[model samples]
Target: MPFINTSSPHQQNQSSVPDLMRKVLLALIPGALACLYYFGFGVLVNIVIASATALASETIMLNLRHYPVRRYLTDYSALVTAILLALALPATVPWWLTVIATSFAIVIAKQLYGGLGYNPFNPAMIGYVVALIAFPQQMTQWPVPQPGGALGLLDVLLLQLTGTLSDPAILDAVTSATPMDQIKTGIGLNRTIGEISTGALFGTVAGRGWELVNLLFLLGGLWLLWKKVINWQIPVAVLSALFFWSWMFNLYDGDLYSSPFFHLFSGGTMLCAFFIATDPVTASTTHWGRLIYGMGIGILTFIIRNWGGYPDGIAFAVILMNMAVPTIDYYTQPRVFGHQDED
Candidate 1:
């Protein structure tokens, strides 16, 4: 008798790697559109460049690793990593920077670490952090939103390609401090939260155009939840923990600490809480472990943003928490069905 030896998950779902990746891409649509509307066409351009670079890097790396190229390339994991990294970047960064980041993400962060499931850190975030650390000036150059009379799409693209402008004054005119940068600068000047909140960078809760972007990210996150693409534990834990810390600090010194609303709506808080923290492979697998992992990310994010060097700490926070997943999973493992507790 020839018996079939099968793995544990005998129950079949219709989903494949490509299918899941497609769903995640769909979930990112609303946030991407919002970014385009606020920032300009540069957002889309960055995505294209990153996607192209990521695919090329993945193909090259797969060949070098002696893995079947078609098998992994069709899965779209590299594309998804590219999209996330592009979205995290400033809209008008140099094209070379985008290429380098995406290449590093796929080749070094993902492929070299035994491909997708085995990577210790989020590949997209690793790419973002590397770009940030290596080229701080280029990384920090964010375009002012459309409402602020930012340059037209063509001009932005030209700048990205050539690294220069017809009139250098145009570059100065169109690019300004991001909301987080503004707040950080204000705090450094010994400005109170009240004073900083009244600046042009702020609208209601966070930045002038950023709250809308965050809102769209929230909607996309909720869609992911409804589609069952992501589990609710990590998102809930991250948001709640961040809220708790922000509230605590605000209550302690209202003048110094920003409100929970600001913390929630500003920068990449919603995106990280929903999409980044919930990476199935890199995040904790056990139920209780996920909550602990997310809470760690949230608390670390809050600490780094408020007291540490970075204005927005999502990348650093996520990477740091990724290191703790093994310990969290070990402690939170479910008991075996027939096994009795050891005395």
Candidate 2:
């Protein structure tokens, strides 16, 4: 009789929540590799430490809430949250930064609203925004992608753990500038795009290495689209809207507003467009809603980059739009079939 109950109409969807989350984690690999190549081994170290910390915090919180610790921890939400946060953060950020941010992300931003699906904010972005707000200097210390061995896992771990780095000199200089920072500062000082964009900025980007890294993420994003892991509506919409606005502004005054490519490859444009905005729980499920949600993010991203205090707008924009998901879904809901005039 219990087996017969399996045929009941109240069965859950075939695709498990855990399975979807796993696929998202897998999609991050190519982009992560690109980031590692550009930034250094520090990113890899960040991933491992952050993920481990996320798991531990998630376990502890689950226990505190009297939830099934083993089952939920194994679901790997914490690991994904850690990975995304690690990706967003600067390589040379201190170890405690990761620990505190990861804990807050998993506990308050995620579980406090009644665990994963119930949370309104994206866990990774929540943590990232908090870190950025609390420690602006550390969060902004992005690294340049050098030709040779810029970083190593063990070296970073040593620095993180003991504060007695193997080569303290090299470790101290590991930080580099992000493309957005370059453009923002350049434009501020009345330096033409050609002046400040010298080092990594020479090769068709504000930061040379960063352009390629964003390119790799774009490729991976397309791959996700092809695999149907994410819908194209959001990414394409976000990118296009951003480009259109940036282009218009640049045309109006190239001195103040940056070029369209700067808006595209700079900061977390590609990654956020594809990954964060596609979160099913936080994003609208309806097709039209997806397009509108994406447009909102893109508009906010451009506005913030141009005028907001932060150089990057992805985290703030995502969290803000997350609050509107319910309204986006409600109006975008498709009418029930064969209900015409039947109500």
Candidate 3:
């Protein structure tokens, strides 16, 4: 008698790689739109350039590796990586920087490690870290929030392409250090939180335009949770850990430590907590492992942001936690059914 071949997950939903990727892409829209509104057309241009480069690089790598290029391309994983990396980048970065980062993410970070499921790190974070380390100046050149006048599409294109503008004063007027940068510098100069918070760059909760961006991203992340695309353990753990640390330190010295609200609402905290750190392939798999992994990321991000060289530490924090997922899962795995401990 012939027997049926069945896998452990005999009951399966309709979820496929493409479906998951599509949902994630949809979830990113609100945050992306907010970035565009605050940062200008450069945000859109970065996405376009990064997406095109990701597709082209993915295709080339697939063809060279003798894989079925068309089938894999349909998954939209590369596009997600490209868009995530682009969003993490400064909107006004040179166009070639976007191209380089996206290509490296697809070719080295994703494909070089045997593609999607086999990779151990988040490709987008890897790409962003690479670009940041290689070109610190360009990576930190964030545009001022709600500039007096937004750069036109042509102006953005010209500036990104040639690293120059017809009017030098416009470039100077539009660019400034991000809120995270300002806070770090201010604290280093012995300025109190009250003093720094008075700057025009600081908004109600965080930065002028960044607070709303983070809130929108938080909404998108909530949507992803509602759609069942991501688990709750990672995000909840990350935020809880971050809040606990920031709140504790703020109590110690309000002048030296920023409030939890600022930490939560500034920079890419929401983005990392939800989307980047929750990457299924690179993140911890076991239930308890995810919590530990997320807590590790949250703690590391706080440490790096306060004392390390970078203004925003999400990229570094994610990458560091990604390296420990294997160990976390090994120790935190649930006991198998009918298994007993040897006492």
Among these predictions, the greatest lDDT belongs to 3
lDDT of 2 by residue, 1-343 (tens): 3554456568555767677678778888888888888777778878987998899889888999999988898777788889989999887778889888888899899989899788988999999999999999888877666743366767766766665677667755765557677777777888876566665434674466667767877887887788777898989888998899999998998777878988898778888998888887788888899898898899999998888889899999898889988898998888789667435
Q: TM-scores of the models, in the given order? A: 0.95, 0.89, 0.96
* Each model's lDDT: 0.88, 0.82, 0.92
Task: State each model's C-alpha RMSD to the native.
Answer: 2.7, 3.5, 2.3
In what order do the candidates fall by TM-score, top score first? Answer: 3, 1, 2
lDDT of 1 by residue, 1-343 (tens): 9999999889877778888889889888998898888888888889999999999999999999999999899998999999999999998899999999999888888888999899999999999999999998888878887652377767877888888877888887777777778777888999998998887668888887889888989999999899888889998999999999999999999888889988889889988988888988899988899899989998998999888877789999999989999889989999999999897
Residue pairs that clash (backbone atoms under 3 angstroms), model 3? none
Candidate 1: stretches off by over 4 Å: 1-11, 147-149
Worst 10 residues of 1 by lDDT: 145-154
Kindly give the number of clashing pairs for every candidate: 0, 3, 0
Which runs of model 2 end up more than 4 angstroms from their true locations?
Answer: 1-13, 152-155, 162-173, 338-343
Badly placed stretches (over 4 Å) of model 3 are: 1-10, 147-149
Error of 3 at 208 (Å): 1.1
Cα lDDT of model 3 by residue, 122-144, tens digit: 99999999999999999998988
Model 1: per-residue Cα lDDT at residue 83? 96
Q: What's the lDDT of the predicted structure labeled candidate 1?
A: 0.88
